[model samples]
Target: MSVLDTAFVDTELSKKTSIFGLHLWVVIGIVVGAVIVLIPSNLFASLPRAAGAAARALPEIQIDMGKVEHRVVFSDRGASSGESRATSGAETGSFGDENVIGEGGYGIVYYGMLADNTKVAIKNLLNNRGQAEKEFKVEVEAIGRVRHKNLVRLLGYCVEGAYRMLVYEYIDNGNLDHLAYLHEGLEPKVVHRDIKSSNILLDRNWHPKLSDFGLAKLLNSERSYVTTRVMGTFGYVAPEYACTGMLNEKSDIYSFGILIMEIITGRAPVDYSRPPGEVNLIDWLKMMVGNRKSEEVVDPKLPERPASKALKRVILVALRCVDPDAQKRPKMGHVIHMLESEDLLSRDERRIARDSSSSLREEPSASRLEQQTKQ
Candidate 1:
């Protein structure tokens, strides 16, 4: 009787122990499931705070459109009372007295460095009112929304009190005017009404970028003709526009044509030394295209003769852009297409002779990679 009673007690103890183990596992599973469900929400809840903290720890970057100024913290050190005025119209000492990179009618450019060691070009406007202000506002609006690789970017601006400043990405290669005339020894003849080489800036890879919008006019307006005070580089100005104060987009096209010709022949638009025959780029190109000696007109520096056809096509497109009749001139968009298309469009075929003689060559150089990025 005692042995049977002891056996029953042992059996009952084993069953209770098994039941306890099962209950323990069920409690653990519930706890783990609850934790898993709460984790993602907890992480998300903390994200904004983490981001705010990080932003606070970083140096402040402020753009003041009123003064045309860009202010950047030079160090992790807190701002002094004087530096605090930077929030207003005060110009900080961070930029100091940097050497002038370039100067134009409207502004002086200075090379600046941020606290984070980023290089930037600071353009301080000399003429703050009248057409300059209009141009500045238009440029700000136009460049702010558009992010194209080919176009120079407007990082920020300041338009405070009497001061106006524009900040832009620093380009290492300087301007195309340097390459087209100075370094290459080509006299630029085409009237760049606003010419003087500073308008054409070069990118990191040495590709040319057209800059300085103070004088550039939008062409597609209903007025069709821009009746403004005659202004531009003497050599680059179109004859009609120069003679009659009536400017059009074709004026730019003419200037660009002169620039292209300068790039090709390594001659300035008005080279006094080019004997009697080759003084003007337009006249020279007119002779080349008329005589069908298009291949003869190319920059000797460029490699691969196959690109000559493309170059000639570009030249012809430039001419069409500068057609004596403003009504006949192609729009910038069409001009861009004419320059870009390898095969002639149905409409372009009427304007340009297909240059099939030159086979398709390697892709455009990496220097022009930005142009592709815009597309």
Candidate 2:
């Protein structure tokens, strides 16, 4: 599928309400109930995700729209008192169906405008059983103090009676990019439990920005890994993480591999609509590669085909990232090196990647594996 096709699928899917929303919606609910995690992104490290060359840091402003009591809880270097007023009046109107740009179990994301006409995405969280409240806290904690070129910016938040909302700098386009910063750049590694195509957004310039931190987990240096109940999207969750509930940066590397496959093939991680052999993306891709039919894996919709060597490098990198053994998966930094290098992988690395793909043929489906793990 092409970029256009992915957009169409998203449009059709989001319009229909099924369980929490669609695809791995139910799995996401499990993640919210448990402690979530995050991944990394280093694409365009010098280019900021927000607009303008002179990036301005925003404060976490808490607004009581009902009682007209508002205060800035966390202020950054670039934030100003006047800027707080700009976001205070953002939620003056109703968030009807027309304003909704996206939706999930957590809440509806609406396209709103500030007094200065700055475009923003307002997440109208559903505070059912306090899940939204918890999500809000996690999201804020994950990104409130950090600023990255590849991560979306949290402008502010609002609390009006039962209404809970988060304001974010609106990103118009939809795409994905490198995520090495979260794993290597930060002191306490941030592991994004849910790393899928939908969570990544793009700006007008087409620079990909990683979004949605409601399922992000922060891992300190003291602990090697955090063992919690299973969390994360079904097919994107790492097998070891799903089976043992041991989450670390490597689990994120596995999800990133799935995401790479999604971009290259324009296919969902798990799709039952396809033929039996082609239903599971990883299984199908592995079969194709194992049979030396790797050329057939690229999306047919791509206007121009990639050179064989370039394509081979991408496939090998993805296979390595998704290796069943988290220990075998390369670090995000090494993954980036593989992606950027114009040269092909060494023969040894190529054999390892190929073996990695072949090794998964006997394993159960990603969703089934995760479900069985949960059981």
Instruction: Indicate the residue-level lDDT of 19 in model 1.
Output: 16
Query: What TM-score quantifies how close candidate 2 is to the native fold?
Result: 0.66
Candidate 1 runs further than 4 Å off = 1-98, 104-107, 126-129, 132-143, 160-164, 173-210, 213-234, 239-248, 288-295, 304-312, 336-375
Predictions in order: lDDT: 0.46, 0.58
lDDT leader: 2
Off by more than 4 A, model 2: 1-93, 125-139, 158-164, 174-183, 227-231, 243-245, 347-375
Q: What TM-score, computed on C-alpha atoms, does each candidate reach?
A: 0.52, 0.66
Q: Which ten residues in a row have the lowest lDDT in candidate 2?
A: 25-34
- Model 2, position 344, has a per-residue lDDT of 51
lDDT of 1 by residue, 211-330 (tens): 553233433335656666676666777778878988755565566556555655556778778877678666666666555566677655433233444555555555554455555555
The residue-by-residue lDDT of candidate 2 on 217-285, one tens digit each, is 677789979876566667888999888989988988898788777756768889999999999888887
